[model samples]
Target: MMKKIIFALLVLVATSASAQNGITNDFRFGQGEDSLRCIETITIVNVNLNNKDYATAYTAWKTIFNEFPVARVDTYTNGVKLLNELIKKESDPAKKSEYVKELMNVYDQQIKYLDKLQEITKSKLSAGNILGKKALSYIQYYNNAPVDTIYSMLAKSVEMEKGQSEYAVTERFMKYSALKYKQDKSHGEQIIEDYLNASIYIVEVLDKYHASIERSEKKYQEEGNPRDSLNAIGYGKMIDASRISKSNIDAYFINSGAASCEDLSKIYAPTLEANKDNIEYLNKVLSVMSMLKCTNEDTYLTAAEYALAIEPTAKAAMGCGYRYYKKGEIDRALEFFDQAIELETSITTKAELCYKVGLIHFSLNNYGKARAYANKALGFNNKYGQPHILIAQCYGAANKWSEDDVMNACTYYLCLDRLDRAKAVDPSSKREADKLIAIYSKHTPKVEDLFMRGYEAGRSVKIGGWINETTKIR
Candidate 1:
């Protein structure tokens, strides 16, 4: 009977596999062939360890581990690193500790080779296949975390791995097989819907901790400033206040100024511990970024690094970028902005940041760079009035008059009219309004030419004649 049940289970599994071939085969569930082999070896190592085949397991593991000499390169080898860690912590009284020590020595021996490989691949974060940027993030996260936190974080890393792999497969299919998929509207729509759903999930997860604008407002009242850079406890208190103020853990903490990234992380880490789910996605993003810090140039890159360590997201990256920009570190600013824009999906937010970068470039007199940023800002969101005005200014400076400049001029005047109307309706603006009109009237050539120009133009003889005539009329 047991044999019959096992046969039935195998039949069911085969049937399910066959059925999946027809449910729109756009996504690959697990690792590809090459990576699968590595996963299998790691699985064997784990299973052997469980079976008390420690000697045999060590042999399989050593061969497997040696294959990925750069222990930090990808997830599989990183898992081997974790296995090494587990071996070290094994507390069986009868166990030979030297065996674990030997395993670690093997890992150490491979370290220089890994470091050399890291140098070659450091500039390239994402590939089109399985080991993309997000996978790298998982590897880095697992490498850095404490043991307890590492276990807790594994579930997130798994989710990210699935999402990233599925996304890669879907992207490849769309690029390579769009015609085949396009014929089926239902399948196409389902693919789009699923992608959108994943994007929304990630965005909401990031925004969940975006924090309240009101938190700054409250801090300004409580401490008479936005933050205190001097006292570490003050920063920690600010993070606590932000979390406790909201019943749901939706707002993220941001610590700006002289505080290093680690300081910010330490201060807000308590909040992260209190609200784990919202922070999980960010953790993965931050982890991968920390490993790539050798490329960063800003003084606060370490602080930015810390934020990614605490909670990885485009928001934290943007915060770091704005700081770098303020410090006149243009290249570093651009680096963070590039990362932020690629990760961010919000048009409004992206447009706002683009405008800011444009303004920064404009301030630096990098007109060409400024124009590029301004164009990108407009492309992202055309409705923003300030970007239109900025582009108009850019064109005016270049002595190139285009249709966009004229349109922007009209927009500027229309905006001013609306603002003036609003001010006119308010009692407080009445005095200011009169003062503005007095100044506005002087510069308004049309109004001045119509009323004052002709009067001034033909007045001399008439003025003397009017003075004699006025005396007689009175």
Candidate 2:
């Protein structure tokens, strides 16, 4: 046991002496005749690091870090690990802050020396990735770090990588901007700009991931088997990241209070006028304005006009429709709603547009036109319950009935049928449909009233005029 202890002490002394000599000589590989000494120090540092002996690792690590900062990529990579361990083990706040600063420096050095090291060692480390690591570390460890400083680091990282930016980095960029906006309202424009950039990048990443997933699914279906495990795992991770990023961004915007109609108009009004000819900018402004429900504002109208003139889209048409609808220009509103339905390819969106037209007709008391529009909505989406209720309302209106008891009472039967259909088709409208059904069932022709009309229960009757629907006597 004494021999073993003596041997261990001797090895330790030799390692310490070797590290000291390397530091004294400023040994660096490819620098001079001390190449072997640099290699020996690197091995010693790596062995200690691998064994979780960060303290011992730091002895040789510091020598290489100071004397040969550009010796190898691992010189910085392993240095990060060593310093982080030091930070964790440190009990003093000042010392921990120093260690944290050193860790950040290590990342910066890695980026500075990355290209040269890549030339020498063929490493794949990118400047963006290094910036991302530094930014993430600052966010996690340095609570007192300047928000702008951290945001700048993340912004540069995102700019460098764009669609390839890390999900966490993009998410953090938005969150930090939101935090800054809350702290200082003067930074509102900057916050909006950051959110736009982050949203664009996130959407691009999501599109790529969704396309990849679709391709994978297609291949799997064609082959009647699963994709390779690595591809499957990669797609799963990307999809999960996209979902999380989307949710985070959505929630951040919804809760940010900066996206309110008044705030959005204030932020986008000037931007819209300055970039009137920039179609892409106009589209972005329109999207944000519409999302914040600022469609009633002049900024929204200006954006909609510019965007529609540049290139009409379903959304642009819908904006115009709402503008006209608000002005009580029923014909113009219907025209734009029709355009929106034609431009829209999504069945659900088309259904909604048709339903809006139906609402306009219902408000005008044009029962025939309203029913036609409602039927058109149902054709697009048969499960749309609101249209069914609208049609029932059109039939149940006082104008649809007359003073003649039998004819007036018969309208209720048709109204009840429409309401029942609504309840059956749309679970969301069940309660409303039930209430309307109860109110209208009492208005249905009583057995005695049907008898007075020379009719009996279960006899077919055609109630003509606006409501031309045929129903059986109750």
Candidate 3:
């Protein structure tokens, strides 16, 4: 036992001396008593941090921060928490700024030590992820930092991460781009393109995030454990911040006036053919062009043609509908319109699709199908009054229901009934409805003629021969 104690002491003395000489230089923990103290203090700092002892944690955390920059990456991670606490508790603006600046430096140092982290702990850290977090922290703490500085960092981070972007960075990149645009309208051209990329990526990432939450919930259900579910909630909250950011960027882009058809065509048309086989590229062009109401542009037509030839997206289908409709292929256009409407999820958009198809049939003098499509539009969105106007127009333009002029004039009741409904559901349609009412009411049959026809003026009448709607005799 005496020999074993002496051997152990020798090993300890050798270890302390080797550590003093910087055995590997992977980290900056000190030598002898200081090295041991740093280790113990770090462990205790984490314990205090975990137990909500921020004050104690901060005091010990600074020692690791200042002397052990090369220590474990957790040193920097914990430093962030400590610095954040200091910044929050600080009453003096100068002191708060100092802490915030130190926090930013901690991120930089974390990046610096990332390559050395494999020696101590497993770390798959990427510069992209760290820079993204740094940029977000800068935004949060630095008030309005230089747009150019934020933009440069955010752009690199997003380009590096691609689809797996830190969501806030992707969102704020577009947002700051908007601010830059306001400062210099010349920035609008690039911002329009930036909005396209950022919006698509953010949407894709959000879908993945939602899918993760769903999987987590499913796993928790099977296991009867809430741990994964709780983690999912935390993850979802982080992504949810991007949701508001997404909305802000969307509003900014829409109102930027940079999405005019000519400008959109210039941006997208030059590359449409080369990207013809690129389904994702085709869809991007179709989506952005359609969003900016560039349907009349040749870029939209070529993109839709390319995308529809490859794989039909919702916007691609809608664009093809326009293509065929303008080519006088009404049947083909309606087919694509029906496909787009089915693929779309929004009720208002579906209504708009149906009404548009109804107008096409009306233009072709197909009143029966026109009214049919119009009624379908109203079914989708009952508050939509334009379809009602379309149906009224169909009734006014239809052939005589009877050889007797009086009986024929009674069709006016059907037309007027649709007009009234249009005015009732949508007050914005009142002017158009009143104008049609004046034209149709002039053709109304006298009460005596209705009485002679065995139809009371106040009773219900079913119009026959294509216009089969129920209406009261006026």
Candidate 4:
């Protein structure tokens, strides 16, 4: 017995000396009895955890956790898993609540050693990641947490991580932000702020991960690996899942309905002076405002011109176009507008810019050019009702269809046909289309006039000029 006891003491002394020298692994298990105790306890507890023996794991877990708190990140991670299982399984409310609090402490203790763990090991852990997990834990187990509590945690995490933020956390942050807006209309500006920030990074992360998969597939294909097709298909499914999670945030933003063009102009105006020099912030501001169709606002024009001075963007050009257009500089305005169209890539945005330029031409009473630009816009987006509306208006404004009085009267019929087509392709245009239909329906040729002109109800007649159209002369 004496020999065995002395051998144990020597082992403790050696182990303690080794720990003091600095360790590359085994985390913060420390020296002497503490190190041995943690090693043994964690081993036994992890076995129990893996075996679904929570009761045994719980008994041993606390002793090591209290004694050697920083033993490893895995210690805390496993603690959370079993605690969650316990909480989920527990029928008794009071016991379950106590377990939840203990689980909270595990996260807290992990944070205390966060930096130290990274210093000692190759842990890629970050403060933002830690806080994000805690926030998710609150959502999972402590769900009654106040809105501000969850919102604040998520904000810190998102700001810290940016494009590094996990899609799950970003998605949750936007969801809670929408809730915040729903509960109080006063939160609209804040919601818009969060929306812009979160959206920028969410897309970035999606692209990054997508690029990773592509690179991997390309490498495998170049190696002529038989698993190449299977690997790409499998990885593609993962990216698709991420896409769904990231996209939910945008859907939530729309549901919030917080930031419109006019509202954004008001919200961002005061901050422009401070943010003018911040190129990234200014670009984001310009992009957000442009997306909201706030391009016509004075505040938007200012941001556009300011951003242009720092870096020329499509939004900036578009904004400058509106400014010149507002000042009645038609030639300069069209130049900037064309620049905007050429710089933009999205089909929808290009379609909108074309429509805007078409509207500009219509304002100048250049009916043929207006129709030409309107047709250009439709070529970009066939289902775009606004361009169809513009074309119909162009025909009506021209008010000339060959010098025949009967043909001129028949113009209303063709105009009504375009209006009907507009509403058919896009339901959102139905109200405006109906209004035009109501106004022009009264101008159709009377039955006596049609009879005298020898034009049957179902007879198709082609109207020529800038308004070249064929329709039945009903």
**Highest-scoring model, lDDT:** 4
Instruction: Name the candidate, 1 or 4, with the larger lDDT value.
Output: 4
Candidate 1 segments exceeding 4 Å error: 1-303, 307-313, 392-474
Considering only N, C-alpha and C atoms within 3 Å, which residue pairs clash in candidate 3? none
Q: Write the per-residue lDDT of candidate 3 for residues 14-83, one digit (tens) a residue.
A: 3353343223553256566656666667777888999988889988888777776665568877888788
Give me the runs in candidate 3 sitting further than 4 Å from their true place: 1-14, 19-34, 50-56, 118-123, 228-242, 269-284, 307-318, 325-474
TM-score per model over all chains: 0.27, 0.58, 0.62, 0.61
Model 4 Cα lDDT, one tens digit per residue, 1-474: 645644554454336544531234453665665556556777788789989999899889887777666656677878888899899999999999999899878878778777666764675888887788888988887767888889889989999999788888888899989988898888887888888777777766656655565666787878878577677666555555555665587789877788777778777898998999877877777778765567778888888888888877777898899889889898999999899888876555677789889998998999788888888887765556788888888888887756777678788888898899888655557889999999888888887888887888899978887687798976
RMSD of 1: 25.7
CA displacement after TM-score superposition, residue 373 of candidate 4 (Å):
19
Full candidate order by TM-score, most accurate first: 3, 4, 2, 1
lDDT of 2 by residue, 327-420 (tens): 8887897898789889976565577678878888888887788889899988866656789999889888843456686677788877877888
Instruction: Give model 3's TM-score versus the native structure.
Output: 0.62
Q: Model 4: clashing residue pairs?
A: none
Candidate 2 TM-score, true structure as reference: 0.58
Rank the models by lDDT, top first.
Answer: 4, 3, 2, 1
